[model samples]
Every structure is written in C-alpha cells, then in structure tokens.
Target: MKEEEILPKLLSCFKETVEINQLIQKEINGKDIFDSYYESDLYKERIYKIQDLDTSIGILIGRLYKTSINLNYYYFDCPSQVYLNHIEEREKIYFDENIEADEKDFLLNEIQYFNNPEVNRSLDFGNFDCYSYGKYIDYEERFKITIRRKLEYLSQRLEKYNLTVDIQEETNIIDDNGNMIGYGTEAIVRTKIDKEIEPIETKSKNQLTANQIILLLQEIGFFIHPKIEDASKVKQAELISLITGLHQKNIKTNIQKLDKSVSENGANYQRDIDKINKILDDLV
Candidate 1:
C-alpha cells in the first residue's frame, strides 16, 4: 500500500501498542511514575522501568504487522493480506528487530527505492519496444511473394480452426504492387508503439557507498569459496592482519605462508573486507 494508507495503519498500531504498554505498566506499578518522581532518587531507578516500558511498547508495535523486504520492490501488510502479485523471483524477507529510529528511517528510504510501486511499474513499462517493416517489389517481387504466402497460410489456419479471418490487401498505385502493410507510403505502411519508461530517483550517496562495500564482499567471497583448500587460511590471515594493523606487504607475507600450507592458492586476490564493511556501517 501507499504511504498515505500506511501511515494510518502504523499510527493505529502504535497507538494500540502504547495503550497496551500503559495498561501493563499501570497494573504493575499501581500508578504512573511521572506524577511521583522526575526530580528525585526515585526517578533514577525509574529510568530503567521507563526504558523497559519503551522497549516493550516497541516490540509490541512491531509484532502487530509484517515487514516485507524485496530486491526490486518492497511491500508491507499485516499478516492477513501479505500475498502479492507480479513480483519477480526475489523473495521477500523480514527483520524482527526494533531497530533504532534513525536506522529505521534510513532503511525505509532504501526500501522505498526498490518497492515503490510506481517505480517498479515504470521499469517494466520502459522495456517495451515496437518495430515496423516494409518491403518494396522493385526487383523479383520476392518480398511481395513472401507476404502473400504468409497471408495464404494464415487464411488456411483460420479455416482449419473455424475462426473468422480478415484478409485485406491493397494495390499501390505508385509502386504498382499488391501487399499488406508493406513498402513505403507509395505501397504500404506499418507502425508500432513503444512503451516509454520513466526515470528512477537517483540513489543517495550513502546507498552508493553501501553498494560499493557489497561488491567488495562479493569479490572476497570468490576468494574463499569452499571448493578451495586452505581457503580458510587466507580469510584467517586477513582477519589477523586486520586486528594487528599490519602493512599490505606484511599481510601478503602472512597470506603467502598460509598459502604455502595449502595447495589450492592459485592467484588468490588480496582484499580489505574490513575496511569495506566499516565504510558500509558508517553510511548506515
């Protein structure tokens, strides 16, 4: 659903969860904390209680709905209406955490990039193409003859299937040829319409940074595939070098020793996976 529709549902769920938390807190404390103490020792101890209550409310609020994560489109609905149509093979997943507020908004923006319905539909629309062709009968009339043969075949198919068929061919006064939607305006005309695609919003700088990290991770994954022996050695040496703050030459020296221990170390690429991850985390 659109944001206009989603806001109310989210608000309602938040309100309901808040109410439930209020009731639970009231039942446990027999009174509210704000009325008794915000300026005293009681307040310090009560801070923990307030935090507990807030966490409870957040969890309850989250449990009331489902979150759908899509690669190309994001969709969200309550459990009752979670099914959707026309999504590509990328599966929808969910995160159950009550993430921090800033992180949540940032993630929502990223999700909107893929799941925005207008954007998704526009992507599908943009790939539509149309073509038009024509044939002139100046030489041996092979083009015209092929067109007639196809038409005759189509007519026979219509008769065999007992279906109505419309066969219309016009003679061109300029070219003096008989054809269907063939040749130039002097003989025939054919037209096709292409579906236009709308442009998507440019990605945020933060998102671009994260994508870069993911690409690096993918490259590292290739270096440590399970099929290779001592694959774990290179990964381990990289991890050790990360903690030890070793120079590139030093890290390579360590990795070479590990490679010497294992037979399948052909051209293993060097990668700084930690730095890439740090960059991604900073953006998030």
Candidate 2:
C-alpha cells in the first residue's frame, strides 16, 4: 500500500516476466527435431498460456500502481492487413474484363508499390504466410525487444521514486504525411503523497482524462472530417486547441502554434506534479 513497497512487487513481477521471456526464447530456438516447431499444437498451447500469464501479471501490477493507461500511439496501423485486403480486391478487379485499361494499370502499380520493401517496411511479401511458426518467431523477437526497451525506460524513470513499475502502452509518432515514425510507452504510478497547496487561479483546474480529450477535440470542429484513426494526432490537437485555441490540419502545425502562455502553464503544471511525486517518494 505504501510507495516504497511498490518497487519490490514490481521487481518480482519483472523477474517472472524475464523468466517467461527466456523460456519462450529457448522454445523459439528449438533443438534437434524441435527446430522451428512452434507450429505444433503443444507449442501453440504453451505460447498461449505464457501470453495469458503475462497479461494477468501486467494487470496485477497496474492495480498495484493505481495508475490508469492513456493511449498515446497506435503501433498497429497494420499496413500488412491493409495490403492483404487490397490484394484480394485488386485480384477481383483485374479479372473483370469490363475494367478500363488505365484503372487496371493503376491497380497493378499500387500492388507493386505495396510489395516493394523500400516503399513500406510493414508490407507482408509472404502474404499471410508470416503467421506460421518460423515467421512468428521473428515476430516474437521484435515484440520481445519492444517489451525490454519499455521495461528499461520505466525502471529508470521509477528509480527516482525508489519504485519500479512496468506497463506497456504504445504511442505512435507520425510524420507530416501521417506515416508512423516512432512511438512512446507509458505506465501509471499511484502513491499516497500528501496533497500539495493549490494556487488560487489554477487550483480548481482538473486534468482531462483521455476520453474527455477525444470528445473535446471533436467538439472543437474538424477541418474536413474527423481523423480519429490516428490517435496521437488527436491528442496533440486537443492540447494545442486548449492552449492556443487554434486548429490545424496536422499535428506538427498544431504543436508549432503553442505560445508563451500555454508553454508556461504546462511547465508549471508539470513542476507541481513532479513536486507532489517527490514528496510522495520521500514519504514512502
């Protein structure tokens, strides 16, 4: 229940996670006849069990932290899914003699573009074949790296509070063209830190929950139609609108519009949160 006590539990949970990851890694490597055998019914069952256990542990750890998750990014734009769906449709169109020559050429070019690795990294040249044992291992390895990086970041961040926590949430950073470039991860920390003194004007201000921010952005008005598909941009727009009261077609534009007053208020609010967290850390 206390702040100091939280770290030990987190460390213990992480130890379990590490063990599970190691076990999975070993299975993925396979030995003798077992090499590349993740396709076996037994292996599939074991993999699912490990995944379920990991989810359960993560949930338990979140409860201990008392912090809720905010969706910062979407790592799963799933371009592979899009490419596959389009392939099926394109095939049907290609077979249609009634289709125009120019339209058919356009479809062929689009498919070729999706197939090009230099054009899109997420393209699945294997079609759905990547769902098999050998390919799944590759997928698992990438996922493992992502999880480890997140844990490392959180452990370092919580070290200041003498607590360690691990929670995985994706925040997809996109470029001006709405292409995903990178992402961020976040976790929650709940401590029994005593409430700090409230400044007169800012004291009554409430932080908006993730859902509230979404609704607020929709109410502010959309340029064309709502772009809810890219959550990171939506979040950026929400902050920019709140601070500058101006709307932009894209995230970068909105961020660039932040003025001195908005910047100072954000800094002050963060300082307050940090002060409160440090106080809570000391108390535990």
Which has the greatest lDDT?
Answer: 2
Q: How well is each residue in 30-147 modelled by candidate 1, as lDDT tens digits?
A: 5566554446565455556656645543443333333322222222222212222321122222232334434333333333332221222111112242111111012124323333
What's the residue-level lDDT of 279 in candidate 2? Answer: 47
Error of 1 at 14 (Å): 5.8
Q: What TM-scores do the predictions have? A: 0.20, 0.26
Which regions in candidate 1 have their CA more than 4 angstroms from the true location? 1-39, 65-80, 83-284
- Pairs that collide in candidate 2 are 73-171, 73-172
Tens digit of per-residue lDDT, candidate 2, span 98-200: 4655543444344233222222323122334211111111223334344444345434544555544333232223344645343322232322131123111
List candidate 2 stretches off by more than 4 Å. Answer: 1-13, 30-36, 59-284
TM-score of 1: 0.20
All-Cα superposition RMSD per candidate:
27.8, 22.1
Tell me how candidate 2 scores on lDDT: 0.40
